[model samples]
Target: MADIATLFVAEGPAAFGVDSYQWVSLAMLVLIGVFIWKKVPGMITGGLDDKIAQIKQQLDEAKALRAEAETLREEYASKIAGAQKDAEKMMEGARREADAILAKAEADSEAMVARRQRMAEDKIAAAERDAVDNVRASAANAAAAASRSIIAEKHDAEADRALADKVISSI
Candidate 1:
């Protein structure tokens, strides 16, 4: 116990008065905390303000882009409508032309049919007339042959001459 006391005495005031060092350490910690508290909020607020300004600028750009997109959409819609109208008009024109062509073809066909029918009728009438003339000539030839045979068998020369004259006059 005496040796322990001697060692304690040798350690001196620093060992006996540790409360003062503890107080100094506590005071330094408080001073550092106070310095951080005083300065950190201003720095954080300034950085947040810069970030907010950047966000607002980005939002404005996005709004402008949206407006441009809307304008483009409207313009394209009108163009599409105009193109549709043009296509419809073109189709209508084509249909009308086709109808006209069909009507012309029908008229030409009818005219051709009528001409063919008229030609056929005329040919038929001419053939009928030729047949009647041929039959009449054959009948006359037969009658003349019979008369010549009868005359040669029984009639005199004067009778043959008179018959010939009558045949010529009738013809």
Candidate 2:
């Protein structure tokens, strides 16, 4: 009874008649043998390799998408720059046209003013000529009237007949 009681409480087997540690070791060995026979390690490693390949494929796709996005961004940027340049050129052209229009309008207005001034000067000259002609005509009419009155007052019928007889005797 004492020997059986000591065996139950003993830390190790004094002489090997299988102990609890031996039973646990035997169970671990059987489990390892089953895993090997089923090729569980190979299956686990293969699944992990497939997962790694899938992740690599996703990374490659992401890289390609990023590259395409970068290309599109650059293309749009260049188009925007070109559009801005075209807008600036159009604005410059419009400014030049406006300046030309303004200059032409100013020149036309000046020409019109000069033409109107010339027309007014011609009208004034014509009026002055008409006034001088009217003054000359009035003077000529007054002189003729004075000469007729003098001739009628200074001459008579008797003096006119004596001058006629003397002219006839000499002939």
Candidate 3:
């Protein structure tokens, strides 16, 4: 319901004119058509899909590695615990052996001391016996010398002849 002059101006541009808004509109439409014809949207969707798949795979691998690490940690912890128990057992054995060795050494030392003491006592007893024997011998010798002197001073040959006659008669 508009006049021809107003419609022409509102329609944006004359078809034959180079300087017009219509030309820009046509170029934008053609660019959009080209993009659609080339499947650009499909290419973008495929790329995004591939990236999602890669990320999911990486996540799964990370989960698996984490599980393996946990298992390894548990294994090493158990091994360390076992090793500690073994070490403690070894230490106990060493202590027991050391105590036994010390006790044996002490016993042996005491035995040696006792043997030496017995040997010293035996030596002292032997010395005492020898001393008593020597004293007895010296006493007997002194008594014999005194008797000889007494007989030589008090008794002459007559006393000896009398003692001989008395012994002959008694026999």
Candidate 4:
């Protein structure tokens, strides 16, 4: 153990001394830093500019689309309003037509009812006239029969012959 410790102590300073390997490592580090400093910032700036341009283009397109949508909405709203007005006009016209038809039907029905009533009244009047004529004829026949019976009861055969002869002479 003691020999091993002594060997390490003897090599430590020699390994740390300025040498060809140290100079080469330092040169490599300086070259890498110089390359990054000269070229990397420009590449980063170009990438950022490209991304910003793309974002601006997308924003302009979105604005255009929104304006177009607003115009379409206004156009559609006006069309819907016109359609509604037309529908209301049609409905009003239909209602007026229906009312006219109903009024015509009512007038026709009233005229028909009046005609029927007049015909019925005429028929009733004719029936009453016929009944009156029949009563008069019956009364006349009954009076004639009563006169004949009274004459037959009052007179004998000879008197009846004499009365008939006289009635014929007078006529």
Candidate 5:
């Protein structure tokens, strides 16, 4: 620090009555005097204030835009949530309808099977009845033939006359 202060003092004596250090100081003072005379500091302060105000306005606009973006994001999120719920509801309804259709198909299949089974049972009963009736008719024919043979083989003409006379006396 002391060395810097010595640099500002008129310590050097190189030519032309004044020291080189004093000439540098004189040039520095003239530059400061010119700056003060032209009112450059006030102009600089005014320019800085204008820049700060412009920056503040930009910040305010950015804040307003950010708020609007947040609002849009929230609205879109709500809409997406609602859409997902609607999709789920639709899926559930479709599932219920599919289940109902499956149940109906199962019931219809069962009923059809039962009806076919009943028809088969009726056919079997009819076949059994036909078989029994055929057997009864065959038995009756056989019995009549056997009786005719026995009567034809056993009875002579005289025996038949005697049987007729006996039956007439009994009547």
Candidate 6:
């Protein structure tokens, strides 16, 4: 049984006068020749080139997107600055208008005060004139009463008749 197992052992040269190592080398050479005949290396290199082109195209697209984003950011920043300036201008205009309105209100109030003062003075002057007229009328009435009493005390009926007869003979 041991001899039978040894009969197929690889302890000597292989068939067709070639060793097993030489046959393996020959098989490796034929495989290399077949790969060269099929242009497998060119195909691998061409596939690598195509991948590199695709990656480069993607990189270019990324760069363009980055540039467009930067442009949009700058444009929005300028618009925000312009909006702030416009808001400040509007606030300044409102302040100026408020000041003008306040000044006009003050002027109107002062004019109204002056007009009221003048009206009060005119009323006082009219009251003074009325008081003076009343005093004058009272004085005239007292004088007339005193003169009538004096005339009645000095003159009599006979003196009046003699003076009347003298005046009638002269006419």
Best by TM-score: 3
What TM-score does each of the candidates earn?
Answer: 0.56, 0.60, 0.68, 0.53, 0.57, 0.58
Best by the lDDT measure: 3
| TM-score for candidate 1 | 0.56
lDDT of each: 0.89, 0.91, 0.93, 0.86, 0.92, 0.92
- Total clashing pairs for each candidate: 0, 0, 0, 0, 0, 0
Which pairs clash inside model 5?
none
Q: State the displacement of the C-alpha of residue 58, model 6, in Å, after optimal TM-score superposition.
A: 1.2
lDDT of 6 by residue, 25-59 (tens): 99999998988899888888999999999999999
Name the runs in model 1 displaced over 4 angstroms.
1-39, 140-171
Worst 10 residues of 3 by lDDT: 10-19
Q: What does the lDDT read for residue 3 in candidate 4?
A: 90
Tens-digit per-residue lDDT, 1-171, candidate 4: 999898765332234575656767888989978878788767888899999999999999999999999999999999999999999999999999999999999999999999999999988888888888888888878888887888778877999899899999999
Candidate 1, residues 1-171, lDDT tens digits: the string is: 999898756443554456656667988989979878888767888899999999999999999999999999999999999999999999999999999999999999999999999999989989998988888888889889999897678998888799999999999
Best first by TM-score, ranked: 3, 2, 6, 5, 1, 4
**Over all chains combined, what TM-score does candidate 5 have?**
0.57
Error of 6 at 160 (Å): 13
Q: What is the Cα root-mean-square deviation between model 4 and the actual structure?
A: 8.2
- For residues 8-54, could you state the per-residue lDDT of candidate 5 as single tens digits? 77555576787787788999999989888998888899999999999
Candidate 4, residue 152: Cα displacement in angstroms equals 7.3
Off by over 4 Å in 3: 1-25, 144-171
